[model samples]
Target: MLSRRAALRFGAVAIGATAAAAGAAGCSSADDDRAAEPDPLLTALDAARRDADAAAAAAAVTPDRAGALAVIAAERTAHADALATEIARAAGEDPTLPSATTSAAATSAAPITPPTIDALRSMLAESQRGAAALARSLDGYRAGLTGSISAAVGAQQAVLLR
Candidate 1:
């Protein structure tokens, strides 16, 4: 009884309506599921990274101490990058930390003739505390990561102190 054109239009309309309904249902039930709260471990890691970055920037690295400075800076930067990625993945968002270039610039700048021991010590303490906090708060693989980082920071402290 319907014209050919009318039937084709009706079929297209039906398909469109079905698709829209399916999409709405899926979004309402599934896609809406998201993390209600940000992970505290992520927050701790981010804080530690920021402090490490600032400490590296403040420390006085002379020509003789370049090697130690580089090592310290590199480790902190690497941890930060890894943490940022993990945090973003957990939250389903892009990374929120400073980009690598800006972070590296602080370490690359000329330091005082001799290294600042006090500043380095402060930085190490901050890093260690951050790691410890994360270790205490998280478990499983996250606990391992924080515990390892805390130990590593302690070792770095020894190296700086020596």
Candidate 2:
């Protein structure tokens, strides 16, 4: 019994209502399911930080030998920061550290001698090897990462070898 104009208007109203309902439903589930997943870059950064902390602690007992280790620690910290930045960028979060807090604890320790240098060198060499291994592993696992991460890792290894 409806006239042609009324039928067309009814059809348009029905289509619009269906589309609005579909849009509302679509907007309700926009949260990414993968947002809760752990970030590999963050994990790598934490591991690097812990390794640097251990090295710094070992060197703390020897003031004379601490300089090289401190330098290495600084480098590791910088690398960690870089990794953190990458992770944050991927996550759409801020990358800056909360504070400039350091993990190097104070030690009333004595200076190590030439013999200690050999031990330090050996330890450093081992750490460099480990870092290189880690870099390779990361490269294999995360192909999407920027090249700078690998480059930083390579530079760290080179510095450790020196």
Kindly give the number of clashing pairs for every candidate. 0, 0
- What tens-digit string does per-residue lDDT give for candidate 2 at 20-69? 99998776565355566675455556555655665576567767657766
lDDT of 1 by residue, 81-147 (tens): 6666566656556566554433554566544333275667676777798788878888887788778
- lDDT scores for all predictions? 0.67, 0.57
> Where does model 1 exceed 4 Å of error?
1-34, 55-61, 93-115
Best by TM-score: 1
* Candidate with the greatest lDDT versus the true structure: 1
- For candidate 1, report its TM-score: 0.58
- The C-alpha TM-scores of every prediction are 0.58, 0.49
